[model samples]
Target: MIKIISCILLVFASTYSFACKDPLYKDKYQITNFSGYSDVIVARIITSKHNDDEMYSPLMSFDAAVLEKIKGALTPNQVIHVSAKIEDPRAACPLYFKENSTYLLLLERQEGELQISRFSFPIESNNEHFSSYLSQVKSGINIH
Candidate 1:
């Protein structure tokens, strides 16, 4: 029992220790052509799985359901896959989405698949910061 508890603690500590405390980019670009940049959606992360087998490096896979389509042709309730590297918070660009949480995501298309944009990070749907972006997306205002 003691060993199991210790192992759990260690794993928890390791994951938290990798959390990034700062945004990858501080500037927000006015999204002139929304579709040209990426597809914007309000989605809930259904599951997040960690995989380190692709490149022998840690990465997270997020399977999400599109709750609302702010822009682009994505159908609501559609599932999408997104991946992000597991690295120190300061060095990682792709924002990690928590399982079961809804987020305003700006997704770019890569190799025929939708992906987290190389621009800004994901914002929780209920977060104060999400409204501004949501409004911008709805209004067709350039801002990601």
Candidate 2:
């Protein structure tokens, strides 16, 4: 009887754990007005003429593909929101990039443009089990 009760309790705990999880990278980070998506290494952005500060207000580079999706719509010196995954808390210091940092990029298109928009960071999935999480988010978007 005790063994049977223990099994039932274990099943209940597992079900509850699964139910509480968030999908869609929603809990991870999100971006709005995200222009495009690109798969690139982190080193490129660090080496480029556009460092953290030059980008302005909130300074940081994002995935090339996401930037491309919205670049055409921005005007020179305009503020835009950028949403990105916060891999390192120290990367955007003084003004810490929000936790679970998915949002939007508000940027100013400048002359002699460094094309920082073209930069990207490779998505690292080895650390987290994100397959079901991403699928759930995708489904939520479709529903809307």
Best by the lDDT measure: 1
Report lDDT (Cα) of residue 31, candidate 1: 52
In candidate 2, stretches whose alpha carbon ends up further than 4 angstroms from where it belongs are 1-59, 66-123
Q: Against the true structure, candidate 1 has what lDDT?
A: 0.67
Candidate 1: give the clashing pairs: 20-89, 30-142, 31-142, 31-143
**TM-score for each candidate, following the candidate numbering:** 0.62, 0.23
Candidate 1 TM-score over all chains jointly: 0.62
- Model 2 RMSD in Å is 14.1
Candidate lDDT (C-alpha), each: 0.67, 0.33
Best by TM-score: 1
Tell me how far the alpha carbon of residue 126 in candidate 1 is from the true structure, in angstroms, after superposition: 2.6
Count residue pairs with overlapping backbones in model 1.
4
Q: Could you give candidate 1's per-residue lDDT for residues 1-144 as a string of tens digits?
A: 999999999999998876645453223424535656467888999987755554323336689999997777788989888765334445444445678999877777767776554244667877665777677667674434
Backbone collision tally, model 2: 22
